[model samples]
Target: MVHVGRPRERVGITRRSLFGGVAGVGATALLAACGTSTAPSAPSAGSRSADAGGGPSRVVALSTGHLDHCLALGIVPVGLAVAVSEATDSRGIPDYIKQAFGDRYDLDSIQVVGQRMSPDLEKVAGLKPDLILSNKRADKGLTEKLTGIARTVQTNGGSEQFKADLKIVAEAFGKAADGERLLADYEGRARAWGARRGTPGTFSLVRGKGDQYLYFGTRALASIVGTDAGLTRPAAQQFDEAASRTLSLEQVGLLDADWVFYSFPGNSGDFTEAPLWKKLPAVAEGRAFRVDVDPWFLNASTVAADRVLADMQRFMST
Candidate 1:
């Protein structure tokens, strides 16, 4: 169901069917904006190109994941769409990103075009950006609309394809070598960290939101990082076809592991307080810790991967 720019190629598989019947009950909509999208506005000459040599500079990030990729490649977007968590932030940038960029960039100045699901096309057009970085979340209709405003590039998958996504984003920005090097560096660091840890026991990743508990699978950012670090996943979380498996509080024991990392969009009480949750070995042993949803669940680039690795080290030690 995800399509991108022409010559009319299908860039991503449909995530709709991947989550079982969640799409029918509006849960998929909630997850759809895991990243954000841009809006439309009038295109101007200023938006055409930021350089005399036809290189893109005034880029508009249609998704936060793409935004992370841009930042990783040393590019600060002229504008970006934000996820719900990001929209709530006064600065419109995630805290991890703020700390990562530090004073090297002015985070507040980047215009927030709109939410991921509903980008303000007019605002995006108003920015007159030369490039638009998005994921497959930008449908054919949105892609056409975006192409009219600026050159648009979308990767094949969302967080599920972070490696390929980062490479695609880097290529679009004309930094293929840098992108490859970044990936290699991340792989090296992850392996080195794994080696230092010797044989850490299985790690479990869960997310609490509303009434449901999400068990991350192979496609999730944290899961991917765990694999890179040579960590093991509980059998329930070993699959790759879907991003995650939705579990009811009654099934909390399925998330049990030697170490458990859980995060929520806000407070963690929703699914964490259930009776089954307390019975989990990790929870009983005080090995479960709450984590931030931004880099762990939302952002899926090298920058976020690094944060996930650091978080793993910190949480495992505690």
Candidate 2:
């Protein structure tokens, strides 16, 4: 079953405002918009089953969220779509995936499948993916349409769901052993991170763009980081109704916590220059950390979750 959400409203802003009044757009913004095309087109299709002996030969990754999981299990799809802007490193794709696979992975082989809110159905169809894997919440409609052209699987955005999806992808590619090992390794690392830092610290996850701020729910990176680091989440009415909730600049003061991890919309860092943002205690105290929305939060999958953990460790240690 394919699921769709309300389309995101595009807010027009002047170039000067986007770059924090800098002379040119930042590298983060350029990377974020990279390979992103508004045009829609049908994707190519082909298949290879894991148990059938050799595994899926012609694969297509519809969701960037799952790209790391696929790469960990030695499955490289013919197509991949991810928000590269939020990546910690400029490698664009996850480092482990790139190191293991090399430059043979071509961006042209991958198509821009649209952002978290809006998916380009035409582009997905044009890729003709053999097996489509994505978060159940984000790609419900696209999954259904892709199924007509190829097999499709859905995984929840949660950590447990991410592991399950990895296993399923591994089985599809006949790499169940590798998948198991990868899961074990990931769990081991998480446990180590937790053990070194015993009790977990409090954290608030927010995304800022200009004057607007969106608070991520427990299901987001804040929750993931909190859980992984053995920390507690602050009680703030738990806005579980939406994936994210918008907060005013004044309201941000209410989110007082040990650490703050935030992302910017469309890769613009203009919000950092806003006087109201600078007034936040977290910002004033140097506890505020900025993340790119695409790779950091929205593109989160099993693979990217590891990076999140690493970043959290760095942030917490400091």
lDDT against the true structure, per candidate, is 0.68, 0.54
Q: What TM-score would candidate 1 get against the native?
A: 0.80
Worst 10 residues of 1 by lDDT: 1-10
Error of 1 at 142 (Å): 1.0
* Candidate 1 lDDT over residue span 184-294, tens digit each: 766776777678778857888888655566888878988889888889898888888888888776778788789888886555566767788888888898999877778
Kindly list the per-residue Cα lDDT of model 2 for residues 1-318, writing each as its tens digit. Answer: 221111022221111112222213343443232223221111111122323465555455655656656644434465555544434343245443443234323323344566534556576666656676656766457566667767766666654356677777766666676667655655566666677677766777777645566777766644664576577666762556565777775676656677878877553466567677777777889988875454355655555565565556556666
Q: In model 1, which runs have C-alpha deviations exceeding 4 angstroms? A: 1-54, 86-91, 265-270
All candidates' TM-scores? 0.80, 0.67
